[model samples]
Target: MRKGLPILLALMMASTAVGARAESIGHADLARLNETVGAIGRRLADTDARKSDASALLTGRLAGIGAKGQWQVPTFDTLAGKPTLHTIPVDFMLAQLRLQTGGKFAPNAHKAIANGAAPALFIRGGVMSLDELAKLAATQHPGAIEQRGQSFIAHWPIVIWSDAGLVLSAGQQLELSTGEGAFVLNSGLFTIDRASLSSTPEKNAILPEFRPFLATAMTGAVQAREARFSNLGYGETGVTSGLSIVGAALYPAKMRSSFSDSSFVGLNAVSLENARDIAIVGNRFQKMVGPAIAMSGVTNSQILGNVMMGTRMAQAIDVQNRTSDIEITGNVVLNNRGSGIFIANDARDVTIEANLLSGNGRGGVSVVRSACIDISDNVIVSNAQVGIKIRASDALSLSGNDLIANAGAGISVLDQQKGALISVADNAFSANKSGLYGGAASEVALNANDFAGQSPILLDGEFAAYVPELLRMSSSPEGAPQAFTIHPNAKSTTGQTSRPDCKTGS
Candidate 1:
């Protein structure tokens, strides 16, 4: 009996260590951090940095060669041979630090992934209900599942551990039983199809730490279709990854992820970082606290057929960090506190077309430090700032767009003297405070643009118009709305129609 007891203990240890070795985003960083902490002890360690303050540290970055910011680690993605400059997230660093100092570090994702849902709940997935899943898991891990009629509750905070896949779908209701309850995807497939993840009683109302959220990491893939996330996320670290997918950009492009026909209500924006080949379509974003969709280092993806409304203090769509080859089209972004679309950080080869951008607090589209961007065939109206503001960019072509009645200039090209290439043609501008600002008229080649029957409306009004000091005129530019045509059926989610005649709509 004594010999058998040792054998039993060995089996238990093996089970606990099943996925001890896995791939994680910051496992190597965590190792190096430990070494630094040991050697340096207190010196040079940002001791005040905590897991809760991750988002605040994201702002510390500098551009150009040989400029050191606060970051100590090299970035995962490289540009042409130069290492990308970015700060290691403070909260993420703090998350690992706490684990090491007092607890255990989060293990890397398990190497082998099962084909379907969580192995404990699903033998082989063909779509099962929560009741069946809880029953099956109860036999192995007792008290893990609690039931209340149609809703099932998890005994603890849900972590789809490195080796696991969780597919919650088919009218299932998995309530976040605790305020700190969350669903973390670590190198696995997390699918929420026709299912819901919600803290119905609103845990945030009581314990602020009870923020329920969904975060994916370590090359994890998310497939959410017709799913709903409510009362789920906060803007701080440890819980900030609200409906987020932070993938490795250099990872195989064939590994596709998608979020379509879903709904995010009263949550932090959907964030995608270092992700590739994703499709975000037919989603409804409502009353988000910040940018409805925040993307960084993402490539070869499409943001289409989505309706983003009532974003607070940020653009509806914010793309940054050299994210190239993306298409932001067929989306209705309006009434946001910031710009409609904001792009920056040398991001290139983007198409912003067939979108209805109106009533934004900032520019309809703002591009900075990006290149090879095309903005066309959209209604940019009633925006608080310029319809399209370009700075420190190259190869920007703005054609086939209607810029009307904006509080600021229709087009503001701030860096044309700095060798930025902007070619504007076949666009209609009406009632803009300034048609064009900055850029020299001599620098533009106007042979391609027809300058027939044009009206000079660049702040030449008697009632004191609002215009920037500088103006860039294109050989008495043409108001040729006829040259451009949009799809006849283009309409926003609120059923607001986009004008196909290239004319201003009431």
Candidate 2:
């Protein structure tokens, strides 16, 4: 039933790399490796009475018909030169893993017995992720280590670890809350447009340790919009916490991933780290425990036009680490249990504009250890704490904004690090407990700020609110009130938040 006389008797190396596209077989050892594995599948099928002969088809041919009448084939388009990588069909890989345990393995494994070789294969399945695979492998069969960087000598020595390219088109439904949760890691080119991927609540009790999640690795690319991800995640840490793009930093500039016009409910967070060229826009995040969106070490991204509410105990937007070149624009952040926006840990070169920040538990905008941040044209109203809390930051501009009805001061410049310059003007301050609460160490210049009840009251200095000369706008640094040089490297972002619908949070 097979072709050619290419007899493959020798075992493959413990780790073998597969090319992305099928080319001519170059090395004799590779040809032998393929043919030998093919022969091993046939031999296992002949003796393994528990499995039907049709299940033994190991090639990437017609797998059994799916519940939806679609065929399930191997989805392997992986990187080059990865250790323990294989290009065989997924079923073929599963078959080969069954041969590693020699007929004594867990119930999850596909059983087989080698006539001359003693079927001893243990390829792990039904686990949530690769990290969980490492922990749960020994539970299936002892002394069976399939972790990366470990050496295991099976009858067929090559390891079978591959990445997946998952696509859920429109009008499709993917169930994640099955008995064996469907956790897809090492993701590649994932696209789910107008589709739904969710977990059912009733199935949560059967399995306790693992929850379903789909995350990307180094081979990352995503095009998800108008999609829904709900009730999927485990804890508040790791990429498995929710729908995440973890460590997929190799995305090209042009093929940026975006998750927009979507809905996420009852998840921990849309967590991302060490990735680039991403856009999270026009989405709704509700009932999230942590920040609705958490980004760290990301670059060249945008978070725009989203509505984030009902977060339990975290900010709606949290940008941390060495992230840069981001725009937080046209979003509605309301009633979060924490601060509305939090930018810290040297997150620089960001623009926060045209957003509604109200009804949050903490300050509207919080900045610490960040530079070159611009906050303008935002309605900071009715928050439980101060409108804006800045500490140890430089080159921040607050212009053409409204701060009203906040429980604390309108703006609190807590710690004024040296060389930090804040330019405040053309903003309305009304119904706050105080306006412009800063110490003598705060290097700020205020002009034309329409204060209603309270005005610029320096804690350590005298009140200069009604002084017309001090409030006069001055172009020269020496003539300006609280004269100091604005950071020359930082661009001036004054009066730039005049988009016609900025107030609409569109």
The alpha-carbon lDDT assigned to residue 311 of candidate 2 equals: 81
Candidate 2 is scored at a TM of 0.61
Q: Write the per-residue lDDT of candidate 1 for residues 213-258, one digit (tens) a residue.
A: 5666654566777777776666532225356766543333223677
Model 1 compared with the native: what TM-score? 0.63
Off by over 4 Å in 1: 1-129, 140-143, 161-163, 204-210, 236-239, 249-254, 439-456, 459-506
Clash count, one per candidate: 3, 12
Off by over 4 Å in 2: 1-164, 203-210, 248-254, 453-506
Candidate 2: count the clashes: 12
TM-score of each: 0.63, 0.61
Q: What lDDT, from 0 to 1, does candidate 1 have?
A: 0.54
Query: Which ten-residue region of model 2 has the weakest summed lDDT?
Result: 9-18
**Candidate 2 residue-wise lDDT, 259-336, digit = tens:** 766788878788777678788766777778768888887788888766677689788888999878888876666678
